[model samples]
Target: MTSKVYANAVAALFDLRDGISLMSGGFGLCGIPENSIQEIRRQGIKNIHAISNNIGNSGRGLAWLLKQKQISAATCSYVGGNPDLEEQMLAGEVQVTLVPQGTFSERIRAAGMGIRGFYTPAGYGTLVAEGKEERVFDVPCILELPLGADFAIIKAERGDRFGNLWFKETARNFSPLMAMAARVTIVEVEQLVELGEIEPENVHVPGVFVQRIYQGVDYENAIEIPMYAEQ
Candidate 1:
């Protein structure tokens, strides 16, 4: 129902406050909310905790937040590529909580389902098991805690004013799951169309899960990462 359009990135993210939890939906560079990420850096929101798969490369993606010293902690699966993030973690400026990839995905699913926790054996007998209650399953196992976020930033290939979303191939990435697990989900889309343009079966994220929708500008063609050969 709120079909307004914003002129720039700053206007879109002007309401973000310091120390809030954010769930950024992307795998590396795919499906990242580039414009909103830039706005967050420009706004200088500090002490933020991000739930994401991997921090983006230097000078791009969520790495911009680390470069700007805007993050206080990160709950992520991988954090090796960004040197500033590693340095900050080592210097005690940033806290890092590493979760197994499968468990991490399940936690977000649990959050969306309104479940408190789920059972997982991924981190048993390791540092991840510490401070968690244990219960016997087939032999002996315990469930880890569910994870959720106060806010989520995701990208969609196309979205309508009513908030129905569609995604492009790999860009479908984490956008769907992250949309449901957050208190507020903001969507950045390659195209913004009028309501009823998208087919019902084509909608990946329904309007109920999204709080904001903005048309992204300057979406470049696929970025080539030099570290690995293209798939």
Candidate 2:
């Protein structure tokens, strides 16, 4: 078998081009592919259709791309704390599609599973139902199509040369789903281990879904909101 490892984020994302739909795996600032995102900024790839949760908060993560005006469209569940996205969205700079969180996850999952579409009551009878097919079962339901991307950028706590991955705690959020849905999945890990080092039972995402893997460097891993217990 061929090696799936890359020297760095630039090598992993060498074929990435402008005006492509991109899925970024993260929840707020956690589990984001920091190195890959920085490389995309450096590459100055523009007109990107970005899909992620929150995009980024506090001017970090995907917010860097938004700051560069690289992203032209965004599909996400939340944007409350992301001022960059909010400003762009309100100024008619970036087209924003806000999906219900549950619906968003299902849409991505559907694409990975090869499902064409599914019906859900998530946004029935609201703006979300407009211009879409609606049906009444026990309750009103609206049709949602699968969401797929040309490429996905993911981060993991540990990965092997074969591309097997393991994520930590809440950081595991959307990485696996995005990996499965994208045509090519690029992953950066803090720890690069040998094959079988992670153990079969602990692999969060199987190697088959990932196309490229690299050991990352200089991770800030900034927390969005730091909470402290009162003494």
Candidate 3:
């Protein structure tokens, strides 16, 4: 078969349509596919349903897209730092679903594992349980369904032409799970290596899950909340 590598993020995402469901891998600004997100901006695609740990802060990372009104709905754990996201939410311009950190992780995992839905007590008595089926095992547990997407755009520290990827430190947060949970997974890596450069054991995501891979440029790992000394 031919290689899975693409020339650029634009080519990798050529078939992407508006109103598509998407999963972007990251926690805050770490491990975000900034190049791909920029390409999304350049392409001017709108009305996206986004799933991630957070949508980034201010005018960077996913917040850049959110600021452009590209995102229609977001399902994520944290939305504190991005003022644009909060403003949109308050104005009823965007639909937002706040999931617990652990519940968010499990829902993505359940999709990848082909499970329909699982019960958890995380939000049993709160607003999360409203209208959802509940069963009493030891305590009341609400059914949390799986989440999937049409495409998953992820960033990696390094990868091979065959699509195997490896991420660094905290950057590895949601990339692997997003890779597994999407219909087409596209990865943007800092370094694109030969087929055997990355050993079998070191590979976080196998090529089978990733349909396309590309070398990204100018990665700005911006901190969402920068802490500075008092002046």
**lDDT on C-alpha atoms for all candidate structures:** 0.82, 0.94, 0.89
Best candidate (score: TM-score): 2
| Winning model by lDDT | 2
Task: Provide the lDDT at 121 for model 3.
Answer: 97
Q: Which model is ahead, 1 or 2, in terms of TM-score?
A: 2
Clashes of 2: 0
In model 3, state the lDDT of residue 15: 91
User: Backbone clashes per model, in order?
Assistant: 0, 0, 0
- Residue 161, candidate 2: how far off, in angstroms? 1.4
**Error at 231, model 2, angstroms:** 2.6
- Candidate 2, which segments miss by more than 4 Å at Cα? none
- Per-prediction RMSD in angstroms? 2.4, 0.9, 2.0
Model 1 lDDT tens row, 68-148:
889999998887766777888899988999988888888897898788987777888888888888787875666877788
Give the clashing pairs for model 1.
Answer: none
RMSD over all Cα atoms, model 1: 2.4
Question: What does candidate 2's lDDT look like per residue over 1-231, in tens digits?
Answer: 878999998888999888999999989998899999999999999999999988888899999999999999999999899999999999999999999999999999999989999999999978888998998889889999999999999999999998899999999998899999999999999999988899999999999999999999999999878999999
| Clashing residue pairs, backbone N/CA/C < 3 A, model 2 | none
Please give the lDDT score at residue 192 for candidate 2: 97
